[model samples]
Target chain A: MEIIKIGMADLGVAKPPSRLRTTGLGSCVGVVLYDEVHKVAGMAHVMLPESTLAKNGEPTVGKYADTAIPYLIQQMQKEGASIRHMVAKLAGGAQMFAFLGTNDMMRIGPRNVEACKLALKGAQIKIVAEDTGGNCGRTIELDSTNGVLQIRTVNQGVKEV
Target chain B: MANFTKFGDFQFDVLREIGNIGAGHAATALSKLMQKEIDMKVPQVRIIPFDEVADCVGGAENVVVTVFLRVEGDSPGNMFFILDMDSATHLLHQVTGISKTVQEWEEMEVSALHEIGNILTGSYLSSLADFTQLNLQPSVPGLAVDMAGAILSYGLYALGQTGDFALTIDTAFFEGNDQVKGNFFLIPDPDSLPILFRSLGVPFDGDY
Candidate 1:
């Protein structure tokens, strides 16, 4: 069992015999793209929603879902994975802040989840499962060999995504 | 109502001082973490009633990173760190030293970002402790999705009140051409508000 642990500001790609995992996702979005036929999987833990916001083009590569998802897809395709057979699973998007008053526009978790869905939809990838939106944080795991996604929230038992 | 107004101003002043000291420490820590010269300005402080935070923060279109901390001791209260996404990602990259072009969003990177939150929240809370002469131990910093509504809602829910006073600090970090903007909110209930004010030596008369 080869376990590839993905880190913040980093992405991991694995082939059939490899599995990828990321933990403690709060506000940040974790994405898993898997091709069952080729037994290939890729995971991205994005901090922000879009790279264009990064501007300067200096560090815009995979920081946002807009850029990260496309890059993961291309990488998977290069490794003999077909987009037609690929499925997406996502987790994380917690609202962890407290505010007082009518200025409640700072809902980054739901926006992130929505943005991820939009990006995936634009790319024509089927989203099979998603565990998102809450006041609590989560951890996500992806198994490449079997294309299984597991999500666990704090104080909440692990469940399939 | 008059008493609440007076108390709000008093608390705001103390929170501003806290934000200044906290942001200064955060900048110093960030400079060390990034191994680059970093500059941060004293945050602009505002004590806003709950219903006007969105307007105060300019509508929250951009990304926001929020950290919730439960503070205990002499001055028991809650503190939140709300940062724009641009600043969050920039700070994340600077602290982690990950190549700017790598975009795969791996799990390790997310873990790395958590360390940034820990540092910022730790430094800020430590400053708060010094200002209020209170013992404040913050929990491990965690990330949350939204900035304005969700964080405020969650915070208020925890406090179980409709209207509360928030100390908001506007801050900026600059390193060469890279810059980031963020805010720190000190949400103390009405009762704790007076205690915080007296600690900071701000007089409260309930006027404006």
Candidate 2:
């Protein structure tokens, strides 16, 4: 398997027979898009919820969910991926800092998950599976061949998304 | 109150020594993990009152990684590893051997970063234990958001009023062409403060 590791604030795309993975998702969001027909997969690890929070207005396609998702879809389309056949799997957005209180402004994890959900919804993509919330951080893996999303959290064994 | 003379100089000195030892071990661990020679400097230590922590650290824009270690019997306090976002990402990439362009802030990635935090904090506390002969055991480290204000707020919330003082140390890590800078914030209760200071050979002046 050609495995590609994605780091924070990075994005990756793969066709059939390729695998994409990202680790350490505390308050950060991971988005996986799979096109069943074309057998192509794309994943993005977004650091912030929105690109507006970015220092400059330059706009990074994979740095935020709002921008990254659309960008991923476009890239996949260029690769002959069909929108109707694409399935979405989301992970991460763990509340690594519970002591900060469960409030909106300070809770980046919940906000990240919310933003991802909203972005996918706006893009008309159905969220086939999701693994989110809680106090522990997570690591996620996406298999482009079978569209399997796997999530692993500390002390909490790996589970399929 | 000793005229507030040299405030916590002695305490700071001892903490710096402890930071040196801890950072040494951390550098070794990091070097092995990154498969490169890492240069580390002795950390600069400071003791700041809780209310003034934000000012001392230059507020929230700076990235910070908060680590919680359990001391005494079941009371887990905090240790913060503060840094800039670019440096944090750079260090993370180096430690994991993952390229920077493939950035994906996923759970495993965060866990990988947490693993580094765990190793660094573990080494730090181990050095403290060896020096002070105190059996202070750290808990399984948990990850907090990477912002100074968020980390400080979380630490304050966890320790409450008991967290009267913070022991901070600034250090730098260099690996060939890449370098990263960071600080460790130790938030301990008043009762524990004296114990920590005394462990570091700081003379107490019988002043609150």
Candidate 3:
């Protein structure tokens, strides 16, 4: 019953009877990978879509979807969780502002969601559930014991997927 | 990231002056709207890590109202106006004379708050534009009620592309025994720094 907290541009893994949580996902995506058979879960707070977009510094591997997905899987494998039993669930990736412009950066929410999906698909991981692309912010929690992804937002109530 | 860490006290003092002028105008606008005296603190300018941005208002899970705008033009950047739930409600009551009772009433309340944000931030931007002689335009304001971390992170999108740190120019304001309190944050894009300082005729040597 320990709940591990993941900060922005960070990732972590947890076992059964434990949960993985990340808060304040806005224009960012929270991707959860779970191995049902092994009861292992991993969560990542991805700030951007691609690693190539990083410049002037060493980008945090957990900060981009293309890198974070693979890194999370690697960590899960080290925990003895097999890829064959892994399924993905996603939340967050919301557009906190609107009508700014058609600039790709302005549509970061959809871009993050699309990027996460592409990365997950590239890894051959099936996405079982998702909540994305709204104008509000979300905080997500992954319950490893039951593989339930809980999403909370303001105005809208909490929901479990 | 390390570059900003090297900012001297003089540099920070300069940024603080920018915030003071900008927020001072915003305070004037807010006072006119609410017909109440508004007092703004001396602005604080800092270069902070991305993970700590939301801590200025509260923790990541702290629910609050936010109005965000993208600063586009000569010096592109991000801007945010934030308020806690209680302060938001107080402002709504004072401005629109509406009391929240029904769930459906939330939309109207949010709209009213959005206009207030638009007006205040508009004034803040205009004064900055005038003082710096830079062509700055604010995009349409977007409103959301959510965890402070989530809403504030949107302002960091531009900063995240190049570094893990963000240079934040922030100002906090209150009115009448703290019944209404809010914060304004301005984060310029990494590349926009030189443009900003150049427009102001400040000597720039690529160091903070």
RMSD of each candidate?
A: 16.2, 14.9, 1.8
Interface Cα RMSD per model, in Å?
15.3, 13.5, 1.5
lDDT of 3 by residue, B74-138 (tens): 99998999998888888888889997732345667878889999999999999999999999999
lDDT (tens digit, per residue) of candidate 2 on B1-208: 0122345666567667766787777777777877878787667665555334655456533444555443442223456665555656777777776644213567877777778888877776777678776667775666654444434544443222222344455566676775565566555433455576676667865332
Question: Which candidate comes out best when scored by TM-score?
Answer: 3
Q: Mind sharing the TM-score for model 1?
A: 0.51
Model 3 chain A: weakest 10-residue lDDT segment is A94-103
Q: What DockQ score does model 3 reach against the true complex?
A: 0.69
How well does each candidate reproduce the native contacts, as fnat? 0.06, 0.06, 0.71
Error of model 3, residue B70, in angstroms: 0.9
Per-residue lDDT of candidate 1, residues B68-126 (tens digit)? 66555666566666666566677677677674422344567656766676787688778
- TM-score, A chain, model 3: 0.97
TM-score of each: 0.51, 0.51, 0.94
For this target, which candidate reaches the highest DockQ against the unseen true structure? 3
lDDT of 2 by residue, A32-97 (tens): 999988998999987567766543235556667788889889988988899999889888676666
A52-116: candidate 1 lDDT, tens digit per residue: 44423255345568878998899899988999999999887666542311223236566668878
Stretches of model 1 off by over 4 angstroms after superposition: A1-161, B7-12, B55-61, B100-104, B158-172, B201-208
